[model samples]
Each structure stands twice: as C-alpha cells, then as structure tokens.
Target chain A: MSEFFQQIINGLSLGSIYALIALGYTMVYGILKLINFAHGEVFMLGAYSGYFLASALGVERYSASGQSFPLGLALVVLLGAMALSALLGVTIEALAYRPVRSAPRLTPLITAIGASLFLQNAAVLLFTPNPRPYPPILREVRFTLGGVIVTNIKLAIFVVAIVLMIGLHQFVQRTWTGRAMRAVSMNMDAARLMGIDVNATIRATFAIGSALAAAGGILFGLDQITINPLMGVLTGLKAFVAAVLGGIGNIPGAVVGGLLIGLAEQLTAGYLSPDYRDAITFLILVVILVLKPEGLLGVVRQEKV
Target chain B: MTLVGRRWFCIAGAALLASFSACKKPGGGAAPGGSGSVTTNESSGLIVGHYASLTGNTAHFGQDTDKAVRMAVDDANASGGVLGKPVKLTTLDDRGDTAEAASAVTRLIDVEHVNALIGEVASSLSLAGGRIAQRRGIPMISPSSTNPKVTQVGDYIFRVCFIDPFQGKVMATFARNTLKLDEVAILKDVKNDYSIGLADTFKASFTALGGKIALEQSYSAGDTDFSAQVTAIKATKAQALYVPGYYSEVGAIARTARRLGLKVPLLGGDGWDAPELFSIGGDALNGSYYSNHFAPDGASPKGKAFMAAFKQKYGTEPTGLGMLGYDAAALLFDAVKRAGKLDGAAIRDALAQTKGFEGVAGTITMDKDRNPEKAAAILKIVDGKAKYEATVGP
Candidate 1:
C-alpha cells in the first residue's frame, strides 16, 4: 500500500514537469496553430540557463561546501533562469518562425524542426556534450505521509507547477494582453482589424510558455541532479504527446493529460514491466485518441475563448 | 593435441607454408588473406588503418585512444621500422555513428588498402566496424570494446580488453566473497546492450555462487527518473543494488536511490568509470564498487611507464581506454614484427598464438575466442574519487 502511494507521488511529481512543458506546446498551438517542435530545446536551454545562473550567483561554491542553498538565492536562480529562457524564446520566434510566418504552411513546420536541431547542436557547442551536475539548491528533506515517501524537492515542484498554472489561468482570463491572445487565437484577421497586435501577443504567449518550461527544467535538475544538452529530446517528445493527448490548444487539458501520462507511466513501470512503460504510455494516447479524438477535457471545434 | 588444438596447429602450419612460399617469390609480405584474396599495397611502408569516434558525443574517447595509438606507433618507429619499412597510419572519423563506422572501415579496407586495422573504443561501433573488417578479411583489434558479441563477429575480430562476461563475473565474485552479500537487487538499462549484457552475466555468476536475487527491475538509457524502480527495490530484502549501467545513467540512479533513502552498497561494471560519475552521483556513490580493466593510479610497472610516456606526449594523465589503445597498438606492432610480413593470415595467426605478452594494461594471453583473459581491478568510490580496492583474477 505504501509502495502504491509512493508510486502515485512519483507519478504526480513527474506529471507536473510534463504539464509545464505541455503548456508551452499547447499555448504556441493555441496562438499560431503551429506546433513548435523546438519547445523541447527551449526547455533544455532553460536548464542550461539555470546552471549558468547558479554558477554565476556563487551557488556552486556554496553547494560544493555541502550546504543547502538559501531560499532567497534559490528563488533568484529560478527567476533568473526563467527570464533568460523568455529572451531565448522570443529570439527563436523572431529568428526562426517570424521569417517563415507568411510562407507555405509546411515551411514553418520544417523551420521549427530545423530550429530544434540548431538549438540542440548549439547547446552542445555552448555547454559541451557532458552531463553536468546541477548544484543542489535545497538540502534534501523527505516527508512521509501515511507511509508514503515524499521529498521536499518533489513537493516544491508540485506546488510551484500548480501555482504557475493557476496564475496563467487567471492572467489569460483577466488581463488585456491575455484578451488579445485569445482574440488572435480565435480569428487572427478579425483580431488584427480590432487593433490587437497579434505578433506581440504571440510573442508574449511564447514568453509565458517558455518561462513555465524553464521552471520545469529547474525542478527537473533539482530532482535528477544532472543536466545535459540532449536531455530534452525524449522528454520533449513525451510532453508533445501530453499536449496532443490533452488537446493541442487546450491549456487546462494539457495539465490533465500530463498528470494522467505521469500516473500511467509510474503505475505501468511499478506494476508491470518497466520496458513497456513507454509503449504503454503511447498506447494510452492511441486508445484515448481512438475513443475521443479531441481529448478528455477538450471541446470539439469551438477551441477558443 | 585436442581437436581444436590440432585445428589451430593445422592453420598455423598452413600459414607458415604460405609465408615460406611467399618468401620464395620476388617481393615478400604477399601471404594470402583470410577470404582467399590478396591485397597489394603500392604505397610506401605498411599502412595501418584506424577507425575512431574522432568527432561526436564520445569524441573524448576517440581523442584519448588516438593519442596513445600514435604514441605506440612513434615508439615502434623510434626503435626500428617493421619489415624494413616505417609503419604509416591512416585514421578515419566515424563520428560515433554505426553507419559511419561501417563506411569508415569499408573505405579503410577498400581504398587505403591498409595492412592491419586498430580501434573503436565503443562496443557497438566496434561491432559495426568489425563486420566489414571480417568480410574483407582484414585483421582488426579493438582497444576497449568489451562486449562478448564483438569477437563473435568472426576470427578476424579481436579485442585487447576483457569481455563483459569476464568483468561481470569479477564483480559477482567480489560481491559474494568480498562484500559477502547473499541477496541483492538489479536495476539495469534495458536500452543498453552493455548494461543488459553485464547484468545478465552478473546475475548468472552471482546465482551460481549461491547468492539470491531479491528483486530485479530495469530502466532505459537516457532515463533520469528511477523512482518506480528504486521504490520497488526499497520494498525488497535487497542487501545491495547492482546497477550495471554507464556513468550517465548510473550517477542519476545513485542520486535517486540515495534520495529515496534506499541506502545500500551499489555495484557496477566498467561503464561506471568516468569523472562525470563523481559530479553526477556525488556522495551517493561513496559506497559503490565497480570493475575496470586498470586504474590510472596504482598501475602495473609497464602501465606506469606507458602513463608516463602518455603524459609526456599529451601532457595529461591517461585514461584506462588510453592504456588499452596503447596495448592494442603495441600488441599489433609486436605481432606484425613476428609475422615479418603485411599478410592478414600471417598477422591473424601470429595474434592468435599470443601468450604472456606484457601489455601496459596487463600480461595478455589470447583466449581461443580472441579475448584476453586478464585480472580485473575493482575500485570503490571514496568521496569523489575511485579508490583502488582489490585485483580480482579471472
């Protein structure tokens, strides 16, 4: 029973990060109707930024002395990483996607892929192709809840993810730029005629989505204690699947899909053969798609606010 | 003689006859190749071909191996040229891809017409290159490819390093006799042939030695998360966790295991030897033990000499793979000198009869399967360094 509960906690912890990455894919698709294949690399760049941030802030020196990082310093590292990732997201959009915006539909898609490859290789050149140890931010503390094991880092990840998602929901519902984003997502020409700056709104969406992905990256580094250039490839693929599973343009649906995917993955790995965890996760996506094409939480056709 | 011994004798006698007949001809070193074909090199000297990962994710392994191999060649030339001709080397970059490895070997054999081949630190890449070398009847020796399937490519495929089974058994023996653990859990990488091969061999050998496997689980390579597997092990009666995986995954696994509070001595194979292992695993790896070919520190006398020479040449301490590369080249040069020719069959025969040859890594004796039966070094991770533990004899 404790093992079952432990697996659930594990699933939810992983699911939170997946949701963070899925939100990026979902938001980009919601705005431009184009799947940003490079979103995964954005997440990777986020982790690298966090690594740099920690190193620059002397967290590495503090960490090397076997001390847990202070809360204030940890927050600074997280925010700094997110800010840098936002810049990177905007840069990628301006450089890679914006040029091909008015081109053939397949052009942007292909450019997205090329951008993905470029970012991955650039990271290799920038960071070198070695797994770097992410400085431990918080001294690890484990909490047992009714025989189930939960670590402080996992809990923090879960809380941060939920809070960010809720904040994004509120922003989209209540803010002017959010209104412009929704309007543009609904009908770009109509929103353009209504004086909404579609390009800026789309860039903001990338910025927000990328920030969330960065948060996920930091949390992942904290959890796994290592970061690498190609770390995002499979993870990004899984998050992309999560987005599709939740409804590509549905924000809340992405969260649901990510959590479900995480839970399914852990349960399959814990109860059945770990070899089939990936195959089974993909199978669920297929089964869900076959049964309800839109997604569990997604509405058919009427996708926009 | 035993049937196998008699067969070896017959082949050696035939090779001798072939060499004598070739000697009677105008130009020597015209001995027959394995595939009943002959390669004639109009170019100066014996051109030795090498295929390496030169530029890729594993480029460091390539660079290290390349340095040691060239140094070995330079040493040979400094003493005397082989067969009255200076040995010339041509190396191609495989970029750590199997397709590239295959193509590189093909180009080396087909275009350069190299007399002998050496290289490939990775087992999978070695397997890829070895097939072409075997098909073309070119004698190839891998410096550090440790998979059992590598030598199984053909009689032409050989490795200076011990195979996975040998290292696996070494660890298993250490675990049973040294660590004295009767039960353990295994968390392996299903996606890696190295991890799976090592795990399988360790499991079999440990079980044979009267140890019980408490539980078994697996994860794929590139997987950073191991909560499910670690939790399952935590629920078991495991005294230790045997994780036969590469350093990248092994380090992460160790961190997770420690974080989950499943404190047990970790056991691994040679794949766990890397500087990154310390940074990634940190203090989690303190109690873990791994089997390796040789240690950079506490090396044999010959190994020390090779390391000193390597440091003089490259201005850095040599890695275990570097020593293996040097040994592979040194062994090849010795065999070529003994063969007194550039013939594939003669070189192959000479390599097969190798016994008590003092390599920098160890005194190597070629087993019938073309692998070296050697003593392995077991090292424990103390703090951030791999401290030498005990030398386990095969």
Candidate 2:
C-alpha cells in the first residue's frame, strides 16, 4: 500500500536521526564502559551551535528574509556545529566524566545523569525554553514518488545519515584510532599496558560520537523547524534504547536498532494507534531484553582477567 | 578512591548549595506557615496571592497573565484602590510543575494569609492550586485555564474563560459554517485533559452538525515529531485538521503536515495563542485558523485601550490569555469592591452575583457554575498574523 511505503519512509527518516544519536551512546559505552547520559545534551548543544553559527554567518538572517540559504553554507554550518559539539563533548568528558572515572562504574553513570540534568537546565537558563525557528537551510521542496510524498529535508536526512554511518564504519574498521579504541574497549588497563593512551582513546570516541549526534540534531532541526531546550530529553532516552537494543557496544547494531525503533514507532503510529507508538517501542525493547539479554549484536565475552 | 569520591561529593554539594542560594525566587520573600510573619491580621493592606508557571513550559501563559494582573493592580490603585485599602499582589512561581503549584498555593494560603487567589494559566495547575484555595475557603480566579472541572473544585474557585465544551463547539461550528468544511481530521493529545476533552467535544458537535470526522489520531503532550500522525492524516481525504493541543507541539505539527504536502489548513483552540507559534509555524500556518478568547483585529474600545497599554508596557501584542488575565484580576477587584471588605465569603458572594461586567475580552457575567458566559473569537492566520474572522457567542 502507498500508506505502507509512506510509513516506511517516515520511519526511516526518523530512524536515521535516532541512529545517529544512538551511535554516540554506543561508541561511548564501547570505549568508556560507561553510558554517557549527557550525550543527548551534546546533541542539543549541537543544534544550538548550528543555529547560533548560522545566525553568526548571516544564514539565519537570509532565511528570515525569505531568501534561500546556499547548500554549501549549510554544509559549512553543519561541520562547524559538529566541531563545536565535539569540543563540548570533550569538555564534558574532562570536567564531568573524568573526575568520576576511577571512582566507581556507578559514579560516572550517576555523574552522567547529573551532567545531563545540569546541561538541560543550563540550556533552559541560556535559551529561555522558547522554541526558536531552526533557521531554514533549504526551501521546502516536495517530491511525490508514486503515491508517497517525500520532502527534500527528509531525503537529505536519510542520505546524510546513511553516508555518515558508512564513513564511521570505514573509519572504525580502518583507522589506527579505531584500533586504539578497540584495544581500550577490550581492557582499559591492558590497553594502557600496550602503550595506548586510554584517556585519549576515550576522548576520541566521545568526539566522534558527539559529531554524529550533532549531525542528527541539525537534520532533526531542519525537518522539525523548531528547536527548544528540552527537546533532547525524550529523544535521548529513545536513542539510548536503540543503542541497548542493538548491543550498546556494537556500531552496526546501533544503526539497525535505531532503524527498527523508528520503524516500530512510525508503523505503530501510522497503522495502529498513535498513542501506542512509544508503548510499542518500549515493548519491543522489553521483548528484546527478555529474549536476548546480551542484545542483537552483543557477544557474551569472558572476563578479561 | 573512597576519599576522592567523598571529596567530589562535597564539592558537588557545595555547588548545589551555592546555586540554590544564588538563585532568586520569583516573588518568594515570605517564610514558612508557622513562622512569625504568618498572619496578615492588619486590615490596612489587602494582600492577594497569585501562583503561576512563570519559568517552565507554559511560562509564556504565566508571564503574560502576570503582566496583565500587575497592570490591573496599577489600574485599581490609581482609581482609589479596592475598598480604599492599597491592594498588594503576592505572586509565587510554580515552575510549571503540578507539585510546585500545590506547594506554592499552600504557601500563599498558610504563610502569606492572602484574602484571595488569582493564577495558574493552565487547567491542571489551576486544579492543583485551586483545591488548596477551595479547602482554605479562599476565592480563586483562574485567568485562562478552561477545563470545566477547574471551577468544579468548589464554589470558591472561578474562571473567566469559556470552558472546553464551548471552545470545541465554537471551532466545530466555525468549521461547518464559516469554513464550509464537511470532513475534518482530528488529532488529539491523549495525555492532556484539555486536548482530549476538546477533541471529543469537537467530534461530537461536528457529527451533530452533519460533518464527518475523516480520521482521528492522538499523541502525547511534549512530542517534537508528528511525522507519523501527519502521515496517517495525509492518507485520509480530510478537508481540515482539528488539533486542540498546545502551541509548542502544534507549530511543529503544522510544519510537518505542510512539509508532507497536507495542504488542508489546521484548526486549533486557545492553546495556539503564543508568539512562538508564528516563528515556529511560519508560512506553513498561514491559512490555519484557531479559536481564542480575544482577537486583536476587531477589539472593543476597552479591549483596544488594554491592548495599547499592554503594548506600551510589554512591547508585544497581548494574546487572549493576557486579556483574560486582565479581566480576571479586574473582576476580582470589582467583586472585592462590591463586597466592601477583604473578607473571602463576602467577595465570593459578590463574584457569584456578578453580571454584565464589561471586560476587555467580552461583557462577562458569572454563570451558575462559576464560569463566565462569554464569546470565543475565531482568528484566521493570514500572512504571519492572526486576523479576526468571526466570534461565536454563548
């Protein structure tokens, strides 16, 4: 059915953003052995940074005046936002996570939650909780494929998400930093014994993960056209569910999990009842947890000792 | 490691304490209930309490309502204050949290010893704060919270705005008559009492008026994305979409609906009356229309004066919620003046007997149910502005 195709497109578009956000949670867990709860705030900061940077570069002014912003400028803003978000992610690592790193596993997790609440409130204090128009990067252009309608923003989100996922895959599989990350994930002390700077590796993982989340945030802003301080809370939790569903430490699993959650949410909203969208998403999680406690892609590894 | 954790915990504790102390509480100077300053037995000053969501999700409603109430206080003071006693308003921030709203009202009643209460531009919050006012035998007036059950707390609580059924029927009637739309889709919010109630009433009235609901959908309160709901609506051949949700999600919904090529204009209720609606919804919401208490395009002379004064002070156009706030506060003052004293029972009696009071929103008369029998405004969004289309009177 056309509605079925439309729902799939909707699901995939939403899922791509979820995938991007989930990748951050997955990588950080992989590297630090701690779920970075503040990663969602980092994504939120990414959206803000992009908005501020675009305004700084007169792109927002152009959009406000009903003029179309250049695509090249949009890309530049996206990269700039990602870079700023990376620096913020690194700062969060140093200030919030690092101090609590060696204390206990639970300590960093608690600190991450604290940092998340702090950042969420700080955003409200700074941005004033007013949902601002995410300055348009592209004029809304719609294309109907058969009976299903697709917007340029939706297509762009899907394309960029897939491209970024592939690039991350290649980078992780081929790069020396990836090897260092893997070594660190294998055993922190063992990685340090093997002359790998575990801290730097963890920071790099955070930076990459944060950059991915930034991309997600910008795309999400472009599609929604509304950005607010508290937008990250529910979204961050959903992405975390995606990461856990796909095996928290598994990269490809995060993307698949994101897509599945997105599809489940949309399909449920489209065909079933809209109210049950979240219920279904969580139900799938519970079912997945019950069946495969280790996650879809997660391996049951022996203790490193 | 334990020492390090303890040291970090101490630092975190110090930081938390520093922030709490450094943060200024909004209109919060009074001590606890049992404190020495608990009773305001002196009749020289009339203290009225107001609790509002001054800093959270619905802060716009709270802040705007507070502005109008403050202006009303100034007006009353200039015209020989309520019963010759200088009226002082003690406002407390609920932070848009229901628990905070209850505690704030508790503090106002027990600690400040206010004569009356005015506040909480949200229905759920007014419910939280109103229960305390009702139990404590204080008269409370909610500016814009329109849920029928808000006043059902007790006889002591009242609302200036038309209730949810009236708003829903007004929109349904306007849709059938003014817009000439036969089939409309309904997207309700399951978690919100206001949205769900309005949607149900609208559905009932629309069907009664020979209009069919082509589709029905529901979502939660704070959902940022409505792509799924909108896509589902797009599958239907509905002429219009009725979304009686708040502006925060409505704006995004409109954008998503428009982006997905759903050309039918969205219809909404009072929850769509925020400045952010224009900015976030933009050109996508141009053809949409919404129902409200006040529309600036066609205002009464009194309404025009209030609008001008409000614009002069706040530097922005006053929404219907602000107008409702002004009316609520002025009505309270008038009731107190008629009562000839700051006594709660006397003021409540006067408020119950209020009739033909000329308010900026409308000529309001308190009905038997402690609600103002008033007209609702239908405003169509045209080129980034809400233009008055028509008004449906009770």
Candidate 3:
C-alpha cells in the first residue's frame, strides 16, 4: 500500500514532464498539421542552455552548501532557456520547414527528421559526447507522508507544471491571439478569409510550444540531475506517443494521456517486471489505437467529398 | 558557349583521372603487407594498432585509455623502443559499437599490418575485436574489459584486469567480512554483459557466504528512471544495495535511491569509476563502495611516480581505466622485448609465458587462459571523493 502510494507520486512527477513535452507536439500539430519531430532537439538545447546559464551565474558555488531552491537563479536560467529555445524553434522552421511547406507532406516530415539528426550531431560536436551533471538548484529534502517519501523537488515540479498548464489554457481561451490560433487550427483558408494572419499564427504556435518544451527540459534536468545530447530521443518519442494516446491536437487530452502513460509505466515497473515497463507502455498505446481509433478524448469528424 | 563547355569538361576529366591515379597508388602500397604481415619502416619502427570507444556514450573510458597508451608509447620510445625498434601506435575510434570495433580491427590487420592489437574497454566491443585478432593469430590485449568471455574468444586474446568472477568474489567478501552487511538488494543492468555477469557472481558468492539477497530488480542500460525499482527496494528490509552497472545508470540510480530515503550503502564494480559519477550522483553517493582495478589514494612508490607523471601530462589524476591502459601497453611492450622480434607468433608465446610482470595497476601474471591473476582494490566514496579502503585478493 505504501509502495503503491509512493509510485503514484513518482508517476505524477514523471507524467508532469511528459505532459509538458506533449503540449509542444499537440500545439504544433494542432496549428501546422505537422508532427515537429525536431521538437525533442529543441528540448535538449533548452537543457544545455540552462546548464550554461546556471554555470555562468555561479549556481554551483552556492549549490555546494546544499542550499535548497535557488529560486531566483533557477527562474532566470529557465526563462533564458525558453527564450533561446523559442528563437531556435523559429529558425529551424524557417530554414527547414518553410522551404518545403508546399512540397508533399512526406517531404516536410523527412526534413523534420533530418533537422533532428543534424541538431543531435551538431550538439555532440559542440559539447562533446559526454553527459554533464546538472547543477542542483534545489537542495535535497524529503519527508515521508504516510510512509511515502516526497521530495521538495517533486513538489516544485508538480506546482510549476500545473501553473504553466493553467497559464497556457487561459492564454489560449481568453486572448485575441489565442482566438486567432484556434481559428487557424479550425480552417486555415477560412481563417485567412476572416482576416487572420495564418503565418503569424503558425509562428506563434511554434514559439509557445517550444517554450513549453524548454521548461520541461529544464525541469527534467533538475529532477534527474543529468543531461546529455541524445537525452531527448527516447523521451521525445514517448511524449509523442502520449500525445497520440490522448488524441493528438487535443489540449486536455494530452495531459490526461501523459498522466496515464506515466502511471502505467510506474505501476508496471512496481508490480511486474521492470524490464517490461517500456513494452507495456507501448502495448497500451496499441490497444487504445486498435479499440478507439481516435484517442480517449478525440472527436470524430466528417469529411465532405 | 558550346566551345567553353567542352573545354571545362576536358579539364574536369583530366582532374578526375589524376585524383583516381593518386588514390590507386596508396591502395597498391597497402596490399603487399596484408594478412599477419608486419610493417616496419626504414627506421625499424614496428607498427601497432589500438581501437576503443573514443567518441560515443563510453567515450570517457576510451579517452582515458587512449591518453595512457600515448603516454606509455612516449615513455617506451624515450627509453629505447621495443626490441630496439621504435614502436609506432595507430589508434582508431570504434564509437562504442561492436560492428565498428570489428571493422577497426580489420583495418588495422589488413591495411596497417600491425604486429599486435590493443583496446576495447567494454567487454562486448572487446569480444567483437578479439574474435578477429584470434582468427588472424594476432595478440590482442584489453586494458579494462573484465568479462571472462573476452579472453575465452581465443588464446591470442588477453586482458590486464581481473575477470568478473574474481571481482564479484572480492566484493562479496568485503560486504560480508568488512562491511558486515547481511541482507542486500541487487539492481543490475540486464542489457550489459558486464553487469549481468558481475551480478550473477556477486549473488552466488554472497549467498555462499550466508548472506541473503533480499530483493532483485533489473533495468536496461540508458534508462533514466529507477523510481519503481527504488520504491520496491525501499519496501524491503535489505541492509545494502548492489548496483552492478556502468556509471551512467548507476549515478542516476544512486540519486533516485537516496531521494526515496533508502539510506543503505550502495555497492558496485569497476564500471562505477568515472569522473562523471561524482558529478551525476553528487552527495547522494556518499559512503557507497565499489571494487576497482587500482586506487590512486593508496599507491606504491612506482604507482606514485606513474600518478605524478600522468597528472603532469593530463592535468588530472589517472583513473582506473587509464592505469590499466598503461599496464596493458607496458605488458605488451615487455613481451615484445622478451620475444626479441616483431613477429606475431613470437609475441604471443612471450605473452603466454608472462610471469609476474609488474605494472602500474598491479603485478599481472598471465594464466594459461591469458587472463591476468591479480588483486582488486575496494574504494569508498566519502565526501564525494573515492578513498581507498582495502585490497582484496583472489
């Protein structure tokens, strides 16, 4: 019972990161109808940028004393990472996707893959193929709640993730730009006819999505305390699966799907064989796809010929 | 416009022909010295080849080994090269992949005609390269690959580090006698042969010593999450935890285990030795113990000199991998001098008959199987630094 509760806490924290990353995939797919496979690399860059920013700010000097939560420095690093990642996301879109937008859909998909590979290798060349230990922004502190140990880092991750999700929801629902984004997602031609700037809407989607992924990356680094160039490959793939399982392009569904995947993975690892964790996660995806076709929250749409 | 195009096409054709001719000459030069042949220059320099994971996930291992090998070569040349012939070492990066390791060995044997081979810090990569060297009857020595199957490839294959069975026994003895921990949990990397082999040996030895394994869990390499495993282990009443995996996963495991409030000391094998370990595991790994090939904190006079020289050259203390690499190269060079020739068969015979060759890591005596018989060092992490605890012998 204690083990069960402990795993739930772990699952939620892990799921929050997945949800943050899944939002990027869902938002870009919602607006551009493109998978944005290179978003993982954007997340990786964000982690690296945060690492550099923290190092430059001398976070390690204070971290040695086991100080809990260098909140000001951490926030500065987080924002810097998000801003840089947004710029990089836009540049990647302009250089790789925009040129091939009019080409066949497969062409842009291939370009996204190409861009991902290029960025991974580029990072390797620039940083050397070694895992850098992430500076501890929060001191290690844990307290047992009914026999389940909960760390302050975990709580911080949960709070920050929920806050970001809420902020994004309110922005998309209450702002004029948010309405324009929804309009473009619904019907790009119609939205253009309604005096909406489709290009700006697409760019805005990339920027917002990239910024969210950057936040996820930094949080992941802080929690795991390790960052590497290829860290994003498997993680990105899993988050993509999470988005699809929640009905890709659906905002709330992505979060729900992320939590489900995370819970499933933790429960499987806790109860069954640890080796079967990844296999079981993917198995759930297969079963859901076969049974529902559209995700748990996905709506059926009629096509007019 | 037609005339101009024709003239440019003629020039391009001529340039292509010239480049092809230039490339063909080196190809022809390499053919005469193929298949177990030794390539010696006019200066009587013997060609030797090395391959390791210099640019992949395990690049730290390769980079350290490569540095030590270079230092060894420089020392050998300065003190009158092997068998009075200046040794020329050619190293290729295998990128930590088995296929790449095999091809690199092939290139060394077929193209460079190296008299002997060295390298492959990882056991899987060593097995791949060792098979080729064995079939070709070229002597190959590994610096730190401890899996027994590596040398089982053939007699021509050898390693300077003690095999996993002995290392596992050493740790088991330490846990039972030194640390006096009775019940332990085992966390192993299923994908790694080294981890699996070490875990099996440790479990067997520990159980034989009347210590019980309270829990056992497995994870694949490159996994970042160990929460479920840690939670499960936390539920157990185990007194200690044994994590037989590389530093990459072990560091993360240590952090996760500590975060979950499992305060028992963690134990591991030589795979835990790397600079990144401290950085990744941080204070979480304080008080953990691991068995290694060599410990710099308790060095002999000769070992101290080697450490001083290494620090002077590389600006850091030599790691176990680096020390083992120096031993491997030094052992190979000693065998070459004893053989008194650059012949492959002669070197193999000398290496087989090696008895008590003192190396920077330890004194290595090659048994009939070409595996070194030596002692292992136990180190404890205190205040984020590895302090030498004791040396356990087989």
What overall lDDT, based on C-alpha atoms, would model 3 receive against the true structure?
A: 0.86
The alpha-carbon deviation from the true structure for residue B335 of candidate 2, after best TM-score superposition, in angstroms, is 0.8
- For A1-305, candidate 2 gives per-residue lDDT tens digits of 88789889989999999999999999998888888999889989999999898888898678757889988888999999999999999988987888778897999999899889888977876788777788877677899999899988889999999999999999888999999998898888989999998889888998999999999999989887788888888788899899989998999999999999999999988889987887887888788899997688998778646
**Per-residue CA lDDT of candidate 1, range A33-76, in tens?**
88899999999999988888888888877876877788899899
At residue B318, candidate 2 shows an lDDT of: 89
Residue B385 lDDT (model 1): 84
- Chain A only: give the TM-score of model 1: 0.96
**Judged by lDDT, which candidate is best?**
2
Docking class of 1: acceptable
Choose 1 or 3, whichever is better by lDDT.
3
Error of 2 at A196 (Å): 1.8
- TM-scores of all candidate predictions against the true structure: 0.90, 0.95, 0.93
Measured by C-alpha RMSD in angstroms, how accurate is candidate 1? 11.3
DockQ of each: 0.29, 0.61, 0.45
lDDT at position A11, candidate 3: 90
- The candidate, 1 or 2, that scores higher on DockQ is 2
Best by DockQ: 2
Candidate 2 root-mean-square deviation in Å: 2.8
